[model samples]
Target: KALQFQEAKEKRQKTLAALDTMMKGKDEEAIKKLLEQKQQEEAELQERLGEASQKKQAELMSLREQKEEVMRRIHVVEAILIILCVAFSCSKRRLECNSDKNFDRASSLFTSTN
Candidate 1:
C-alpha cells in the first residue's frame, strides 16, 4: 500500500507539469497572433491615408483650372466693351462733321440771294 501511494503522487506531479507547459505555449501563441493583427491594421491605415492625399491633390488641380477659365472669360468681355466704346466715339465725330457742312451751305445760299 505504501509503494502504491508513492507511485500515485509521482504521476500527479508529472501531469501538473505537463499542463503548465501547455498553458505557457498557448499564451505565447496568443501574443504572436495579437502582434500580427496590429501590424495588419497599421498597414491598412497607411493605405487609406495615401488615397486621401491623392484625392485632395486632384481637387486642388480641378479648382485651379476653373479659376483660369473664369479669368479668360473676363478678359474676353473686357475686350468687347473696349471695341464698342471706340465705335461709339467714331460715330459721334462723323455726325458732328456732317451737321457743320449743312450749316455752311445754307449760309452761303442765304448770302447769294440777298
Candidate 2:
C-alpha cells in the first residue's frame, strides 16, 4: 500500500509541473499575431460578402425589368388576337345573312311560277 501511495504522489507532482509549464512558458507575441491574422481574415470575408450581395441585387433588378417587358409584349399580342376574332365573327355573320336572302328570293320565284 505504501508503494502505491508513493507512486500516486509522484504522478500528481509531475502532472502539476506540466500544467505550470504549459500556462507560464507560452509566448504572448505569437498569440497576439495569431489573433490579428484571424481578425484580418474576418474583415476580408465581410467585404467579399458585401460585394456578392450587391451583385445579386443588380441581377435581380435586371430580371425584373425583363419580366415587365415580356408582360407588355404579351398584352399587345392578346389585344391583336381579340381584334382578329371580332373581325372574323362580323364577316361570318355578313356572309350568312347574304346567303339567307338569296335562298328566300329563289323560293319566292319558284312559287310564283307554279
Candidate 3:
C-alpha cells in the first residue's frame, strides 16, 4: 500500500506539470497573436496616411495650376483693354484734326466769295 501511494502521487505530479506547461504555451501564443494584430493595424494606418498625403499634394497642385490660368486670363484682359483705350484716343485725335481742317477750308471759301 505504501508503494502504491507513492506511485499515485508521482503520477499526479507529472499530470500537474504537463498542464502547467500547456497553459504557459497557450499564454505565449495568445501574446504573440495580439502583438501581430497590433502590428497589422499600425501598418494599415500608415498606408492610409500615405494615401491621404498624396491626395492632398495632388489637390494643391491642381489649385496652383488653376490660379496660374486665372492670372494669365486676367493679364490678357488687361492687355486688350489697354489696346482699346489707345485706339479710341487715336480716333478722337484724328476726328478733331479733320474738323479743324474743314473749318479752315470753309473760311477761305467765304473770303474768296466775298
TM-score of each candidate structure, all chains considered together: 0.64, 0.51, 0.74
Q: Per-model C-alpha lDDT, please?
A: 0.73, 0.72, 0.76
- lDDT score, candidate 1: 0.73
- Comparing candidate 1 with candidate 3, which one achieves the higher lDDT? 3
lDDT tens digits, residue span 36-113, model 3: 999999999999999999999999999999998777666556555554554565576765555555445544544443
Error of 2 at 79 (Å): 1.0
Lowest-scoring 10 consecutive residues by lDDT in candidate 1? 105-114
Better of 2 and 3 by TM-score: 3
Q: Which stretches of candidate 1 lie over 4 Å from their true place?
A: 1-3, 91-114
**lDDT (Cα, tens digit) per residue for candidate 1, span 1-114:** 999999999999999999999999999999999999999999999999999999999999999999987776665555445445445655767555555454455445444434
Better of 2 and 3 by lDDT: 3
How displaced is residue 31 in candidate 1, in Å?
Answer: 1.2
Model 2, runs deviating above 4 Å: 1-26, 94-114
